[model samples]
Target: MDTEQQRFMNMKRRVYKIVLPVLTVSLGLSLFMSAHKGLLLTINLILLVGMLFAWLFLSTKLPLRVIEWFLLTLAGIYLLTMVVQGVYTQMLGHGETSLGDFIVWMPMISLLMFLLFDRWPALIANLALFTVLVLPAVPAFPRLNPEQNESLILFYSGIVVYTSLAYFLHQLYRTRAEQNAMLRFAYVDALTGIANRHRIDTWLRKKVELGEETGKLFSLIFFDLDNFKDINDIYGHKTGDDVLRQLSKVVGEELDHGDLFGRWGGEEFVVLTDTGEEESFRLAERLRKALEDHDFGIAGRVTASFGLSVNRPGDTAESVVSRADERMYHAKQAGRNRVTGRTMVSGDG
Candidate 1:
């Protein structure tokens, strides 16, 4: 892949890691506080700091170093909290619990490394369960009694559910990419790399039907290479194919938005310009000259004849195409390598 595409992929990966985790963490924190009576101001501050740190860390280098640093920092915070909680309970003449709580923050710690970051669903799902799931588990960990084992079971159940859901979503993205890739291969020309004749037929039919009621205009520019068969016979078929590929590349570069280009068949192409004959022909001339100036392999510049026409009232696709094709043929007869307007050659249209 190119550098630009690689950069886009990296940015997309980073966005998924950061956005999903943060949202889940925030939601989980809210639920956790709401379900418990011990949501102290200090603990909330600690939660906010840790959550912000996790977000900041998500965008950092997701290697083991970042993870190690985060875990160590979290361990330090927990140690301090344990000491402080001890002091508070002693001052209030209440018993301080012996075992520590850890699984209460599963939403914040599901990912150990950024490199292994899953897609959005994993993080978002954990975020949603933070309070209803983790808040109630404060007294559940560290060898729970039989009565408290339900919290542990529920937490593990959530893990399985989120993992399964995350796997399903990743498959969804993968399947979509594969489908698009296959469609592109099937409907696009392999030589010129533009839409093929099949695509033109399917796409144009839909466009015509759609705009019939909307009153929008679209034009089709018929194009044919001037004396392309001679080039193939003299130079060889491979050279001829190369010339067609190069010609399509030039045409593609000049194509405007809303315009579609395709290879109709051997040495023939079509451009759906979606504009009046004047604008369509203008672009055709530009494409013709571009092809006539470029060199590919040993073959020299190539030239083409083009004919432009708009859809008439009650016009079928075949009729409009025949009219444009006739004009292209007239241009070929009058002189090869010339572009004609909407008029067809005698006995042609």
Candidate 2:
């Protein structure tokens, strides 16, 4: 699954984790408060049993979508029961006809709707609930006192206002999520799923600017698979792609925290680090050795030519990259599978 979908499912799981326990505890209390043998007690027991079942399945590997639908169905049934109870009580002349019991619960139900669905679905569900509440009030309006009329108006207005605000907030959240997804797509390489060249360039420029301001040094290691073209030529590009992916995974594991690794284009990669010349050289040698030791299955033994460059005073991103590129070619010329830097060279020349 993609990161966003995973995040959404995780969020739903967390919501269920909290909501289920709270509902169970509340129902347990209601059962305690109700008469031990009546319909109210019986209904609470049934709900508590359902809640327990939901909690059990939640702890298991039940899909969150199914759980969500189950909860929403329960909510629908509960609302329907409330409406029926209100109508029956009014008909028996034992309760007020103002829908006070049902209306009082609307705000909480509206919040649940917003939490459980996206913008339009939530809005539509809430509007349907509002209509249900409003329809019953319409026929009784002329019989209501002025105070009751005002209360009803205020309640309806509040729901409308709250729904508008919720819709606005959901829209804002969706826009932010879309922007984040777009940014991730732009900066990450599609094939290897590492930072792409654009991200590397942006990172290098920022590092250079930071170094210029703070007088702190940093380094770059530019490397590419030796004879990568030959691999593509002989084994075909599919196997070559697999080799590159495996190579990235291997190199990525060797990097220290705070180091930035990116694909600099086909078969070429770069590493940016806060370490100075000596440490950077050591890191490059480690990467080279790691590559040498790894077997690339059908690609057989494979190695990389590395170029190391430390930041110099007044160095721009282009200049630093150019130096690393030059040294990398020098390493290739000296013989592949070696690291070449300004004052140091490793491997058989």
TM, every model: 0.59, 0.83
Per candidate, the number of residue pairs that clash is 3, 0
Q: In candidate 1, which residue pairs clash? A: 24-127, 31-131, 32-131
lDDT (C-alpha, whole model) for all candidates: 0.64, 0.81
Report the C-alpha lDDT of model 1 over 1-349, residue by residue, as the tens digit: 3764567557755665666476557646674666333634456556556656666665677753454456535634553453345334422225333212444444334442222344555455345433434443454344344434553466457655655555566668768977987888799887777889999888678667755766667788888987788889999999998888888878888898778889999888899977776777778777767776777667765678887778766667787788888888878887767777764322111
Model 2, range 1-349, lDDT digits (tens) per residue? 4876889888878877887788788768755774445443454566568767877788888887777667667666665555444444442244353434334445556666777788899999889877876776677567666765676687778778777888887889889989997999799988898999999999999999999999889999999899999999999999999998999999999999999999999999999999988899989999999999998999998999999899988999999999999999999998999999899899653
| TM-score winner | 2
